[model samples]
Target: MLDDEARRALSRWTVGEPNAIREYAHGAINQTWLIETARGSYAFRRCAQGGAEVVRQNHRLIGEAVARGVPTVAPVVVEDGNTVVVESGRVYALFPFAAGVQVDRDRLSNNDIQAMGRSLADVLEALRGCDRSLVKEGRYEVCVSEAIREIDRLLSVISELPPGEPSDENALERLTTRRAWLVEHGVEDGDPFADFDRQPIHGEFQDRNLFLGDGKVSCIIDWDNASWSPPEWEVAPFLDFVAAYDKVKVAAFLAGYRARCKLPDERLDACVWAYGLYRAHDLWLFREVYDRRNDKARRFLTPGRFKPHFERWLRR
Candidate 1:
């Protein structure tokens, strides 16, 4: 349900009363709302603080993708011809609602994985030259150094924490353990593919972000972290995500991906190891920071969850 201020803020974007302002409580960062009006239903999202520029760039990029016949839930232009609307110092964007269901791991078959792969390849191709202004931090370039410094900072905080706060101490210990694991695995080593082919990738191209309708991908949503990256950087993560459930399904996905786009064999091998380390580092960061702040963050922190996943993939 929406409060009075939220109702007023949303009314500016729609022609009629903003009825059915139901919250879509899936994402961790943004506040999403499903709104219905006399005109049409829309997915309205209040972006996180300091995300206005990212939203603007996404609006531009998604619009370009739609022009190229890609299936994307692009943001709608308000009365002022702006995709983003700032009201009460908060930035919001209204997207034309895509009627589809998000596929879960249990429901994902080889064919579904193939469809996902094909659609993602099409999206990556369509996103070329959309925007060159905002560059997302590449995993190999920043993730390790940043995660290392953050772990040290968190350990300091844990030391200062009042004694007998066993839960806090445990969480911080987990963080340190992950940091050591990453360092032992040579995460801070120099990048092998420093000059790899780079382009804009759907930063969070995973199952939850894809919308399926009529046995096909209807739309790709949430372009918050769209930025320049290597094909392997994005492809490896998507493969890792699907492979977590079943390896056979991942092979089908790779077949579909290769049919549409050429993923260099060497790049894929190196990037998988790089991304595995990055995921290991990132999951621990999520655990340390959000342990007390939000319980949902625990889902990413299941006691060295990505350890074996990284170890196996990196060694291969």
Candidate 2:
């Protein structure tokens, strides 16, 4: 529930009389609310993670993409001609609610998968034309030493935990196994694809951010992670989605993407490798569970959550 002060602040926008405002629980980082008004329902979001500058940049890029025929919802301009309203150090913005369903990976048909791929390609192609000055350069470098040290630190923490749940035990096993894999594979530092050009991409392109309707992507939301990076970084999530390395589905997705833009097989392979290395070094889930004491992340602690994906990427 929003306090009267916050609600009054949001009223400055031209959205209309607010009939209802309810907290939206789906978002992990930003605080969101479904605001119902006489005109229409809107998604009111408080920029939680990034500051006002990021919110403004995202709005600019989203506006650019929408203008270029990308399927996405844009922020509504406020009374001050700005898309976002800064109230007491908090930034808030409203977007017309995008109505669609979020489909799981297994439930997606080949056509749906292909459409998903095509839609992503369309978004990338559209944003690629934007002046690079509008966005910040994205990071492509990988540091194995830091990851190794973090793994060791996590292992040390796990060692102190009193023997209890299977989750703790699983964490121990995963940490040790990942450390060994890092050494055996000789995971090195620095960006392998430094020679490639970087462009603006949807940083967190995944199932949750994508919405489906009528067997096609209705809207691609959450431009918060948008940045300038190698185009292949966006494609890595699809590799993880097509579990067990299902070549047919992979081929369908790639074909769909290729239909809209040029993604050579060699470049795609390199991107997947880069994504795999990222997964191997990623400790956010562990950090959330142990460091932040976030229990919600425990469900993803299953044994096959990461190893299978990493192994598949290796084979590719």
Q: Which numbered prediction scores highest in lDDT against the true structure?
A: 2
Lowest summed lDDT window (length 10), candidate 2? 302-311
RMSD of 1: 3.3
lDDT of 2 by residue, 207-249 (tens): 7778899878898899887878887878887668543368777
lDDT of 1 by residue, 1-316 (tens): 8766566667777557876678986776678998888888888888873566767877787777778888887787778788887778788888888868887876887877888888888887877766666456554544566677877877776677578754565666677777877677644455444767778777888887888888778888887777787766667777766666245776878888888998776766767766665566564445434444655444444443225354666443
Model 1 lDDT-worst window of ten:
297-306
Candidate 2 whole-model C-alpha lDDT, 0 to 1: 0.79
Q: Which residue ranges in model 2 land beyond 4 Å of their true spot?
A: 3-9, 20-22, 158-170, 242-244, 292-298, 305-310, 314-316
